[model samples]
Target: MQVSSLNEVKIYSLSCGKSLPEWLSDRKKRALQKKDVDVRRRIELIQDFEMPTVCTTIKVSKDGQYILATGTYKPRVRCYDTYQLSLKFERCLDSEVVTFEILSDDYSKIVFLHNDRYIEFHSQSGFYYKTRIPKFGRDFSYHYPSCDLYFVGASSEVYRLNLEQGRYLNPLQTDAAENNVCDINSVHGLFATGTIEGRVECWDPRTRNRVGLLDCALNSVTADSEINSLPTISALKFNGALTMAVGTTTGQGKIFTSLEPEHDLNDVCLYPNSGMLLTANETPKMGIYYIPFSKPVLSSSLNQSLPPAFL
Candidate 1:
């Protein structure tokens, strides 16, 4: 999507800091004001009232047609059409949105995981269903084959919610102190979890076994110096085969080759089709790097093709 200027983007205003009833009343008043006005005049009025805030999380739809973002003050989720760069709709939430997953390509099914342990299901029209988990969730991954939603949190267990059965199954136990983020490999169906103790653990959902582990801190340390503290694994993304991108609290972005940008990364995303790696740090701007995978690097240990060097 090409955005030339900020003024070209339209974000609907929620009138933050107001109660739900008051906000609804204000919206009704606006609707009534535009009821008899000319269509062109109403469009001009809407173009004048745009409120931009800090977005906590943002995700592009599978079909690349829409963008979903969550922001605070009074927590709200907004959907924007890529072609128009205009707000399609916005929904206010009871609590802050920790993360969300779009289940369908047409923006039909969505699941929002809140900081208060509440999971809300939303349809294209509006809210559909709701449930609660046991602990505060950090991240989640959807396994399409088994139709299970795996949630990891501040605890050592990964909670499994079966969307097909409409209930949660048994939680998967991990050896880490806390699970930070999880990602499922699209090709081989292997899911990996990044832990607070600086380790990435790979698992097989079919067998429920811990297949492999990578110690980030240990691998990062030079032969001459020792690490004072273990950097927390904050974000993870699997691109192709078993190739993964990892981000840490120490401002390290790794895919075999380490990159220290000196800012703690909030998230990392890989666009394998375009060979682009996107990393969001604590700063206002984001970093986009190119991954040169002309021929995948071979690893003697794993005997598989690894992700190539970054540029």
Candidate 2:
């Protein structure tokens, strides 16, 4: 793999657009022996917060110092040390937490949104920004380089939150008019919002305008008895250049890297930096992925069928 020097992390990765093929002989040897993993890694369930709740969203700080988990329960927000998973802090909320987002470039503050129409920004110790939401729903972020606050979601509004200005922008007539905005992601000046209708739209955060729309809504025609698809758009992110990706609630995420007049998917990301597309529906798992495409990309090793989890 043509990796760049360590001094500059010029995408030091495992492979390229494809992946390095697995060693078929090595797999045969392992099958003969029926060897098992030597080390026993325990899955520790964190139990610092009182009420048991599933984390709908989780964010790790850029410096890898802390983690934030948000959910609906007694203690809505939980903070942990990234290194040891030690409980750092916790907060109880009056309403069920619908979303929790870390809205800082340097992990300085965290923002939690409630179903009761409220938004609060917090530091590690105390609250910094607290206001009632105009409506209820998921909000996407408008990322800025150095600042802490960004735009958030609502049932029928787009919020422009700030620390210094201490004011909110006039509600940018949002898509909550017809579809329930499920999730949002932003990079640079572009932001994308997903809807329960299975559609995703890209918006210019600076202009508060819809730039492009992807028709992912499930549709059935007159002669069809069965529903064709439940096109759920769960997550969105910027890839290379004008490229982007959309992950479904079903965990099958696909990438589109072209702007041609056709719906052609360029690649898929399963393993981080591997660029090996995953088309499986079994095991029910989650993974991180990145596209460090440079040159001399390696071929996928699925012939030997290496384990699909982290190496």
Candidate 3:
């Protein structure tokens, strides 16, 4: 409950009205409630505000202007203004929104992927267009420089979807496994995918050829199921043109540049305008790594060799 100065960090805590301790004295509870009331008076309070349904996913626009959130039961995306903290817009979806992304360069356009379909919409306006994928895609990444193109990973192929054209360009075949997550290195014009086979594949944008691979450590089996020997990648992200991070179902993680060994990383991301990488796992812990555009010195051990890109 201790926090540093505002110059160092700012923190906010929300209450769901769920009491943790079943035996707090009435006087102690009243004192805590009074403290919260005093703190609320100093803040802009939006009392009794509620969404139509439980929110499933929430995200902020890249520019930090708008907040986008989706509901668990309702097929919709709602936009809120950060300055006013007021709901600005809400668009209906054909199905439950699986995930969404606001284009890094064009914050006005948002691409939403659902369980069976995907749609592109203007953040201020309504729906712009919608399309069906050849196969249901679970995750996607946008091409940076072009800003109008993105790649969707399906079961065994990667499909390039150009929002400008409103159709898929071509499918890049991969090892016969489902692609878990894909990330683009726009500076290098390359994209990487973490596959069900527990390997990371780096691709050539123009030719759609496999240019490199990062294999996960499966040297020892720990479970009774043989599937444990094959790590399924749960997350993949490129820090920049030269650095990548991969997290596997086996709770293992690796940094592509040095092929360093890490563990319990379920997801990884690079800060938009900072020399930092973020990772988290089901352990519910997060780690931050600093990178000055070179191979970072991780505390983890280095063992396996990676494809040409790692070296």
For each candidate in turn, the TM-score is 0.69, 0.57, 0.65
Off by over 4 Å in 2: 1-53, 105-107, 145-156, 174-176, 179-187, 218-232, 248-311
Q: Which stretches of candidate 3 lie over 4 Å from their true place?
A: 1-32, 35-53, 104-107, 146-154, 217-229, 253-311
- Report the backbone clash tally of model 3: 0
**Tens digits of per-residue lDDT for model 3, 94-122:** 68776677774334777777777555455
Name the candidate, 2 or 3, with the larger TM-score value: 3
- Which is the leading candidate under TM-score? 1
Clashes of each: 0, 6, 0
For model 1, state the Cα shift of residue 111 in Å.
1.1
- Estimate the Cα RMSD of every predicted model relative to the unseen true structure: 10.8, 12.5, 9.1
Clashes of 2: 6
Residue-level lDDT of model 2, residues 273-309, one tens digit each, is 3342222111112112223542223223222111111
lDDT tens per residue, model 1, 1-311: 11122223222211111122234576675765566343213222111112244456666688877766676657887776756756788889899888888888857888999999999889988889889989899899899898999999889999999988888898889999889889998888898999998899999999989999999766655655444667778767775694676666665432344334445644444433443444544443333444344124312212322222100
Of candidate 2, the 10-residue stretch with the lowest lDDT total is: 302-311
After superposing all C-alphas onto the true structure, candidate 3 shows an RMSD in angstroms of: 9.1
